[model samples]
Target: MMGTRRSVQFGDVITGMLVDGVDGTPYVAATLLVDEQLGVRLEVPYITTSDTAAGETPGEWFETKCPPKNLLLIALEGNISLFDCRYSGHTVRHPAGIAVGKITPADVVLQDRKGDHSDPLEVKELRSDIDGLTEWTGFTAITRHPSVDDENRVKKLDIELRTTDELIWTQGQADMALRTTWSCDSTAEGLTINEGVMLHSTFPAPVPVLTHLEEHRKVASLMTFIFGCPITWRSHSVRDQRFTEKRFSQLIKQNTVKEAARPDPTEKQLRHPLASPSQIGSSGLEAWAASYETWGRFIHPAVSALNSPRTTLENVVVNAAVSMEAAGHLIGEVDGENATYDRRRRKTTATFIYRCLARTGWDWSGICESRVGLARALAKNYNTIKHYGRGDFPDPLETYLVSSTATLVVRLLAIRQAAPDATSEFDSGRHFPAYGRLVEDFKNNGLFIKCDGLFAVSS
Candidate 1:
């Protein structure tokens, strides 16, 4: 029996083995076939090493050719397992970002992390919380990329948000109609990718990016999206109008008495996107009536300077003062009797500006100082223009300082009106070390009488 078995096993083993002869030396290799119940596998069928000679480095360059680095994945029913080079198998990890569900083999993709990041980031949703994705016809996604050098170090990034659809939250279902887009493009001198700023080559960089100014625009746009204001290129200012209970009651009665008021069940209804402010150009006649007479005194110049540019710093100071005046009036307390501009010939004292701003919440320091600085410079430079006095012109630095300050105040006002809730944290109740520009609106009516000897003169 031993002799008969040996003869049969020898024939079978030789058939499975490979024999190679080189230089009178014969090398033999064999493939082992395991039963279904056995859990054995051959890791490296063959290894080639740089240190082939006995005197060479022992384990320096050993590599295997028979065992493969490639993994074979097989999916059956709802389970996926990976098979080894020797046909032994084990389960692999399920990828992230895919929701819990039976994954069909068709959904799998073969990819590695070696592609160029400069390419447009295209994302396709495989699974979503909201059902019927096609219903999101108005969906839009936007990404912004600022310039970054290859090393990816940026001075500061206020925001590098990767967003899909300013509207249409993934978890929430919404329907809205709005269409507007703006892009600015310019070469970045010192910029990079993702150590700070991410790269989006398709979406161009901001146009005419004059540094800090462009950053302001970016913040304003982000605020617009957050506050759910009209998604327009024009930054919408948040106007928080609150009326006291007594005042609200009075207003209701006054409207009712005026005879056009009506209470109707049919009138209380939801609005459609066709008439959505986001879709329609403007909020129409109703909104226009409440808006500024000339956009905004401060914002007008920022968007496009007053048609022709001013040549002098004196003009710049004066412009800042005027913008601050408009902005200051919107915030702080207002005198009911003198709500309108005072008719008397009196310069808007720094004290007056200060008082008005002091009423609102001011979380930032240096703002009042900025305003005062602007006002002081304006008063002096303004005297130069009004009296034709030879006064030193406001230097470029002073001009920019005051201008930026005025811009900040005006922006605050715009932001106050646009995103009132967000501004709550930065209370404008006037930040200190106090400045004289925080003045109350006062007027000197030029009404004075004097008695000289027996006669009285009134001027």
Candidate 2:
């Protein structure tokens, strides 16, 4: 009464799995085609992008859903390789990354079709006798099905592994694009209607200052040792040595760390009032990590309100609250030993936290004074906004400057609390001068009116 599924074997269906994410476009690769068995004629679209014309939205200049091409020339750049096994009657399990398992009847059979998807051609199985059948260049993805109902009826799932390293998606890059007009469009003789400026709501991550990244890396490395586990980061090298104490010791013994190549710190820089390595030891790092995410929520605008395209006063005020609460909590619990958060406005919290760090031998007199003023303003505004739901809206410039500086200050203070030695790594070719610079700027300048760059990113 029912037809048995041949393409599916051992709870695994390989033939009918390949599919596009949004459109359900069938994936018919050069060496694999299941359209006939799946009973679907795949329609591939040629997707590309170009400069937006006048009146077009920013980066909205994409050519999508174009007709299928005779052939797709993709340079996967060593990213498009997958392993499989073939069997006359049974299928094998998919192997994990970089592992070559023993071939049993071969895990899965691969086709070697060099023609287009729409082109009619006889299907042939790839054989060892074929020379180029071992390799292919195309998109790679996996599809899984999970039960969706009480009856355990399966719901098909899709995963897309395609990558895009092309778009700049930078503010300055988009700002530089010129507006184009059609030849037939003529200018009005009277008052010209100015085009309304389009704002970017998606907060693209900014690039990190190289110096801060260096310090953060050291702090992160020191953290792994303190936490007794590998820290998850945005990127990593193959077998990263920074997280491995043995490798770090080996590098230090060999004097191979590039940062350490610089002659010994003129005892003055190391012993500088700002460089007291004994200021704060690893006492509350665990708490810092646990609490960092709370304040971090405000710093990352996208996380705070994902649907919001642009920064608002609420974003800034909430961040201010986050910073102040964190500062108050740390200063009261750690420095004052009061066993609870002080629960004050940002200005008062900043003052208390600053004094707390100062008592611990941290030098903050060199910090920029303007930032303190902003903190005071943020405290006052945050109080009004938090309760009344009304305050000065934070423009992009203000959000980038004030929010970033405030968020960093609280986080850096926490890092210092977790591990003071995190400030410098004599063994590794790394230091925390950027952390020092930020401390100096925050204490001395406190200025947010001017910024050398739009924003910073971290790895």
Candidate 3:
């Protein structure tokens, strides 16, 4: 029951008292500073006493005290638990006889504390809204109708809809729910409507906040995989059902450690998601979750590389190629035919890529359009850059195409393995135009013929 208030943003400063130890320990007045890229830091100022005037400073205090690595900061806004904090540096004011030392935390948790407790608060449920999740879920909670006067001029509009909260999946002692919430505001200028998706997790028993956070991250990663974007938590709140003193006291707003900065996709870019809830259906989602749990070691990094905004084409190509090779080995282990053949001779990277592409039932000829197989061409390019200093580098444009095609192939293989029924939906979706574009680019650049020759020399 946390109130609808704006959450803390980067660059905001909160004044508080830093606690070094358990009860009765002396506290230092400090300020918590949030950074856009460098994460959270605590600044504590030290003043010189009459006897030690100009002799002791904040740096000396830190060195002498050797404060606990993990400290707590208590403030009016909330209590921040700083973990793995390290002394960054100190700024001295010689004339004022004061110095301020900075402590950077590896992890930070900001939470509202309602009452005093000897032990840490236990979290029973966590609810978080992810950016771009509404579009990814494709669940609409609002309908609009325009009203016009007899003059045929539109005067007002009527909006009607029902909020949806449905249980999505359940495992032993845990379950996940999807909630679509909407809000409408009428202003002087016009009416504004906003819709968002909130993911909720309920545990059988109350657990520590860190445990709840791990659960939240697991679901967020799944959303990131399906949404085909770097999904971030828009808001997060936790509740303990055991606390029944008041509605507001039962729920607390919390912010975990900030994630690394990455490029956010535009609205248009989000329109063409890799997969949607509506397209995949409930069964498909369950399958996807299972697949991810089993194959995440191979799948996660590839998806991250493909969707990363700051990486080079060479980096993306290498990551995608490695993932494909790993996935191919996994596939061979499960399929009897491939397993038997592998016992005689280890499968090549090209063979693995070729087998994965075939499983997707996707026609590679459309993109490759080369005498050499698509797998061989991709493997050759991967080796060219992976084993650099041995051969002439590929053209930049060609490398771009190879990176794009390899990532797309990896995506296809993932979907085919997780939800074969959704392959048709994916083929007819936004990827159709993308596939066509790759074909045209290859033809225009004459890479189709050149790729075949490149493969021939490597063979």
Give the range of the ten consecutive residues with the poorest summed lDDT in model 2: 125-134
TM-score of each: 0.29, 0.28, 0.77
Candidate 2 per-residue lDDT over residues 1-459, each given as its tens digit: 322221211122122222212244444332222221221122122222233243221111112212222222122211111112111121223332111111111011122123233332221110011001011111122224454767776675443232222111222211111111111224665433222111111112222122223223333432322221222222110111111111100000011122222232223322222122233322332333334444343223322321222556467446546645555544553443222124542235435434333323333333333333333444544454466565564344434444544443444444454544543352121244544555445445333231122222211
- Using alpha carbons, what is the TM-score of model 3? 0.77
lDDT by residue for model 1 over 27-135, one digit each (tens)?
A: 2232322122222122113322333443211111121112222222211111111112222322223342111111111111112111331222122111111111111
Q: Which segments of model 1 are wrong by more than 4 Å?
A: 1-165, 168-290, 305-316, 328-352, 363-387, 428-459
lDDT rank, highest first?
Answer: 3, 2, 1
Residue 19 in model 1: lDDT: 19
> How many pairs in model 2 have backbone atoms within 3 A of each other, for residues 3 or more apart or on separate chains, i.e. clashes?
27
Q: Write the per-residue lDDT of candidate 3 for residues 1-459, one digit (tens) a residue.
A: 333222456778988787765566567799988776666777898865456644233445464544456677777765666655677777767777577778876545454334443345566777777666777777777878999999999899888866777438753355767777777788999988887778777788877666655655656665555555567765565666544322322121223435423445578757765665665565665666666666776677786785576788988888888888877777763332243133457666667776666665666665554323576667777888988574887778868888878877776667666567775647553356556767777766655633333522110
Arranged by TM-score with the best first, the candidates are 3, 1, 2
